[model samples]
Target chain A: MPQVTLTVNGKSHTVEVEGRTLLVELLREKLGLTGTHVGCDTSQCGACTVHLNGTSVKSCTTLALQADGGVVTTIEGLAAADGTLHPMQEAFREHHALQCGFCTPGMVMSAVDLVNSNPQGLSESDIRHGLEGNLCRCTGYHNIVKAVAAAWPVMHGKETVAAE
Target chain B: MYDFAYEKPTALAAAVASLAGDMDAKALAGGQTFIPVLKQRLNKPTTVVDLAALGLVGITVTADSVTIGAMTTHGEVALSAAVQKAIPALANLASMIGDWQVRHRGTIGGSLANNDPSACYPSAVLALGATIVTDRRSIAADDYFQGMFTTALEQGEIITKVIFPIPQKAAYQKFRNPASRYAMVGVFVAKTAAGVRVAVTGAAQGGVFRHAAFEAALSANFSPDAIAGIATSADDLNSDIHASAEYRAHLIGVMAKRAVAGT
Candidate 1:
């Protein structure tokens, strides 16, 4: 077992892991951040998406050792310490972006990074193209696309909440 | 996913030395494909060398060519203003690769090294006549790719960067497999100072290869109509469940025409 130190969601934790341990396993199993779901272990589904050093990457494909000493932000980290949901999460909820809620966490996480990358704005096609990594089997991506589009303004600080 | 020792070397020399010292060591760059292969137990290595700390990530554009580091991710290359300015076709090709997460983690070097039969980068490299630089030597694009899932890379020969010559006109058109986003048939057409080059990927059974007939026709006319009559033989193409060999062969011409037209 190798000891790896990671600053996940603002806190630093040092833990021991095997060489084959994946970053998603470390986050969900060791750190107990189950919000990052592992829908597909092969990295196709973005259910295991997370932010590593401010960029979105498939956590299932990332080894724990590879992320050593790096900053990791999962779905749990998106909310304020006071419990206010991140604008993206709020927008997802307001837009009913999820069905069964299994893919919401990863969808929200990936959406936030997508919006952050494009500060200007993202069109409907841009949002659809950006969300290609994430698969929502239930929503058919209709409302999910709406959620990402709705979150854009709020995420950019142009609006407080998604329009009703 | 087997138990393997992990080494993260801070220097290129150290990384090379680590790989050379162990015959069973494999260098990991981005790990978009390597990790999946590992997880499936397809490859078992004694040591996995992480190349992230070597600072092998950057893009440089000169008047004649664009040089990209080995570890530069597809997303970075696609979004780079320099790459877009120098070769918009290459940038567009990068942008069209596997979805956002994969693009964020997949590197051009990794894609070229793996030489997946359906990969998109090899077509660009082959069409652009790029130079693949490694720790040991610089290989011309003509001699770099050998076959499917194969390349000219010798053991412990780590790719350092790739230099692509700027073309007067170049474009890549791909018909992607909806599920995997891998190219069912992809064509890259470039009209360079030397001549015109048309490379096809995914459709070839042996791997990416240039279509000399299409190249010749386009060289003479420099238009899609010139190569419209050129056809690829289905006998030598790949046939899988997603696409028949004949269909892939037809797509090769369609995509080549689209590439030449820049549509």
Candidate 2:
């Protein structure tokens, strides 16, 4: 067993893991941060996406030891400590981006990264293409796309939301 | 997945030693493709050598070539300004790989070493006349790719970096499989310093291959109309539920035409 130390959100924890243990398993099983869902187990579903050193990576496919000494931010860490929802989460709630809600956590996590990385702003097609890894089995992408567009302005700290 | 001893060596020599010591030891890079295969129990290695600690990640642009370290992720390459300026087509090819999450972790060397039949990198490498540098020796793109999921890599061999010469005119056009987003037919057209080369992936049964006929046509004329008369035979093309060999053969022409036209 290898002892791996990683910072989740703002907390640091060292955990022992087998070589085969995945990063998702460590986050869910050991740290009790089950907010990150493992929808597809395979890399297809973005449900396991989390910020690794500020970039989104599929945790289900990442080995536990691979994340050693890395910074991770899951859905649980996305909100402010004051209990205010992150802009993207608030956008999802405001625009009803999710239903059946199975994919919300990953969706929100992925969405935040997507918006933040593109400081220049994103178009509707860019959002659609950006979120291609995230599948809403409910097929409710119209509202999701709308919600992402709404969130973009807010995420980039612009006062007025995009008119789209 | 089998329980294997994991080693993350800080130095390249130590990493190579860890892999060379055990024949079953596999080098883990990015883990986009390797982990999925491992989860399916398709591969079992005695020890997994992680290449992350070796710091094999970076990109450099010289006068006429771009050098990318083995561990440089697709996301990094796609987002790199230097790579975009040096070879916009390469950046375009990288951006279209897998997706955002996969791109953040999938490395150029990992894709080359795995050499999946439908991968987009091999086509760019083949067409651009890139050089694949390994721990031991450098292999030309022409000789690096062997076939589907096969390459010229020897046991315990590890790729360090890949150097791509900037082409005067180059573009890649891919017809994607909707479900998997893997290239159903990808054609990279490049007018390099040497000559014109056209590399096609996904459709070929023998994996990524250069189309000599299309290359000759484009070299003489450098236009889509030049290859309009050339016909790609369905023979030796991959046939599956996703695409019939005939359909893929047709796509080869369409994609190559688009690639040449810079669409």
**lDDT, each prediction:** 0.91, 0.91
> Which portion of correct inter-chain contacts appears in model 2?
0.78
Residue B179's lDDT in candidate 1:
84
Would you give me the overall lDDT of model 1? 0.91
- The alpha-carbon lDDT assigned to residue B139 of candidate 2 equals 99
Worst 10 residues of 1 chain A by lDDT: A155-164
Poorly placed runs, candidate 2 (over 4 Å)? A160-164
Model 2 lDDT per residue over A1-164, tens place? 78999999999999999999999999999999999999988788788889999988889999999999999999999889999888788878878888888888888888888999999989999999999888888846988888888888887778654345
- Residue by residue across B122-184, what tens digits does model 2's lDDT show? 999999999999999999999989988989999888999999999997999999989778999
lDDT of 1 by residue, A92-151 (tens): 788788889998888888899999999988999999999888888898999988888888
Per-prediction DockQ: 0.83, 0.83
Residue B69 Cα positional deviation in candidate 2, in Å, after optimal superposition: 0.5
Every candidate's fraction of true contacts kept comes to: 0.78, 0.78
Return the top candidate by DockQ.
1
Interface RMSD of 2: 0.7
